[model samples]
Target: IVDRIDDNKDGYLTTEELKNWIKRVQKRYIYENVAKVWKDYDLNKDDKIAWEEYKQATYGYYLEEFQDATDQHSFKKMLPRDERRFKTADLDGDLAATREEFTAFLHPEEFEHMKNIVVLETLEDIDKNEDGFVDQDEYIADMFANEEGGPEPDWVITEREQFADFRDINKDGKMDKEEIQQWILPQDYDHALAEARHLVYESDVDKDQKLTKEEVLDNWNMFVGSQATNYGEDLTRNHDE
Candidate 1:
C-alpha cells in the first residue's frame, strides 16, 4: 500500500504525496478521442493528473478508473503560441486580464494568480466596468494584477485560498484596489499605486502617456515570475504527437 501520509496530521487530507502512488499505464492514445475531450484532461501543463482541475476537465472520468482512462496520449498539442491566440483568449484586448479572461487564457500556473484576485474580494472593487470580466489593459492600469499564484497551478484547491482572504475587503464577495493594496504593500498603499501607474504612464512615448493595450501587457511578464511556460516551445507548429 502507498503509505506516505497526505497530511502531516492536519486531520484533513492535504499535503499528500501524489507521485508515489500514481500507477502509470500511460501511453500515446488517439488524438480525436482526446481532442473531443480537450477540456476533460490536461490539468496543469506538466501533462499529468489527479488534481482538482483534472477532475473538472475530465468529469466523465470520475466514474472511470485512472488505469482505464486512456491507454495512449490523446491531447492534440499545447495551445497555439501566437498573437492571435492571445487575442482570441483576451477577447477584450486590454492586455492585462480579469479573473474570467485570465483563467481561460493562462497556462495552468497563471490561472492560480487569476483566481486569487477575486477570491472573496468584493466584485464591486475590481469589476470596474461591470463587464463580468475586466479588460486586461485596465487591469494593468490599476495594478490590481500582481505577483500572486499557487505552487501548483493546476490544482483548484490550492494555496491560493489563503491569499483569497486578502481580496474580499468588504466581505461582500469582491476585491477593491484599496483592499488589495493593504495586502500588497502593508502601510505603503500610495507607494504601490504610484509605482504601478508609472509602468503605464512613464512608458508612453506620446505626451498623452495613457496605457496602450500592447504597452500595458509589455510588463505583465515582470509581475508573474514563473518559468514553466512550456506552451510548445519547440513544437511551434501545434501538431498532435
Candidate 2:
C-alpha cells in the first residue's frame, strides 16, 4: 500500500499522493459495488438493466402484497422515488442503464453529469411539503430533530445562521434546486483531500507534513478505515459457494 501510494519513489507519502490514493480507493469501491448490483439486477444478461427488471427484482414483493398502499414509508412511495432516480440516470432516456449509467444511478454524487439528479433527489427528500423548494424549517429538520423541545445547541444555532447566510444564496428564505446543489455539493471542498490531510496530521509523529511507511502502518486502521475493510470483505467473499 505504501509503495503504491509513494508516487514519487521518494520513500514518503505526500498529501497529494495520499489524497489521490484515497480517491482511487473510493472509486474502486463504487465500481465493485456497481458490478455486484448490476449482476443481481441485470436479469437478461444483455449488459443493461432495464427499469422494469430492477423494479420487479427489488420491489415486486411489495407490488404483489401492498399494491394499494400509499403511506409515507410504503414501498409504493419508494417505487416512484427509485423510478425518478433511474430515469435521471438513464442519460439516453431508454429506460435502461449500462454499467456506467448504473454507477451514476448508485452514486450520483461522484459524477459531474449527475449533479442535477442529486440535487433533485435531495430536494425531494427534504422538501416534505413538495413546494419545489426547501424552506429553512425543512432544511434544519433534515439534520436535526428537536423532539424534546429543549433549548437549541450551539451547533444548531450555528447551522441556522449557516442556512441564512450561505445556503439561502438569493436571500429568498428557501433553497431552490440550484441552492440545494451548492449547499450539498460545494465545489470548494474536497472530502478525500480533507480526510487524507487529517490522517497524515494524526499519524505524522515526526512533525513532518509527509508520511513515511512506518507512520502509516503504525496507524493502519486509521488509513485503511471501515470502507476499505468492507471492500476487502466483498472481494474475499465467494458468491459461487
Candidate 3:
C-alpha cells in the first residue's frame, strides 16, 4: 500500500509488486523480525499468514522446533496444530478449552518418555511461583525438586517434605505419588506402574546397561511401563526375600 503499486489496496499486491521487491522485500522484512509486531495485522488475509500463495510472506512461528515431527509424520505439523485444532474444538466460538472439551479430547501421549524425564516432585516444585500450572521450562529444571541426598541426586529426590508434597495434590497433605499421577493425567489408573512413563529398555534407563532394575523404575512413574517388563522384573527380584 505504501508503494501504491497495488493502487486498489485489496490486501494483495499487483504484478508490479509481485515481480519486483514484493517477494524480496517482504522476505527481508519478515526475516529481520520488524514485521513480527504486525503479524496478526495481515491487513488483508484475515490475520492468517498463508505463506505458499504469498510471494514473500511475513509470519509463522519458529518451524525448526517441530521439524523432526514433520520428517517422521506429516509435513502439516510444520504449522501450529493449535491453529487448526482450535476451529474444530471451538466450533461454537468460545475461545477457551473447556472441561467438557478437555475430557472429551486429549493431549498427545506420544512422548511418554517425557514423564520419566519429568518427575512428580519436580512438577510440584516447578509450580513454585505457586501458579498451579507448570511451564515447559520449569519442567526442565530440577528446581521443583531437592537433590536426592541419600543416593542419586540427578535421578531422585531424598527430601521427605518434597515426597510428601508429591502426594498432596491440593497441597492438602494426604495421598502419594501414585495417587497424584492417577488423579492428574490418566483417567482410570490402578496398578503401581499404570501411570508411569513407557520407556524402551534399549534406549533409556539402561542407557549404559549398568544400573540394577531397582535403579531403573525407582526414579519415577513415567520411566516404568509394561514394555519394560524385564527391567521391572529385575527390580522386583531385587526386593525378593
Which candidate number would show the highest TM-score if scored against the true structure? 2
Poorest 10 consecutive residues by lDDT, candidate 1: 19-28
Tens-digit lDDT string for candidate 3 (67-108) = 566453543442334344333433344543332232112222
Q: What value of lDDT does candidate 3 attain over all alpha carbons?
A: 0.36
**lDDT (C-alpha) at residue 200 in model 3:** 23
Between prediction 2 and prediction 3, the one with superior TM-score is: 2
Q: Which digits, one per residue and each the tens of the lDDT, describe model 1 over residues 1-241?
A: 1122122432221111212111110111223334444444444543432234443553434334345434322322111222233344454666433334434443321233333333323233445677553233333335434447433243332324434555454664444565554554355343323443444344444535343434434644532221111212312334332
Clash-forming residue pairs, model 2: none
Clashing residue pairs for model 3? 125-144, 196-221, 197-221, 197-222
Model 2 per-residue lDDT tens digits across residues 198-219: 8788889997899988997898
1 or 2: which has the higher lDDT?
Answer: 2
TM per candidate comes to 0.18, 0.86, 0.21
lDDT of 1 at 120: 25
Model 1 residue 92 lDDT score = 67
By lDDT, highest first, what's the ranking? 2, 3, 1
Go through the candidates in order and give each one's C-alpha lDDT: 0.36, 0.83, 0.36
Residue 42 C-alpha lDDT in model 1: 49
User: Candidate 1 or 3, higher TM-score?
Assistant: 3
Residue 197, model 1: Cα distance from true site in angstroms = 40
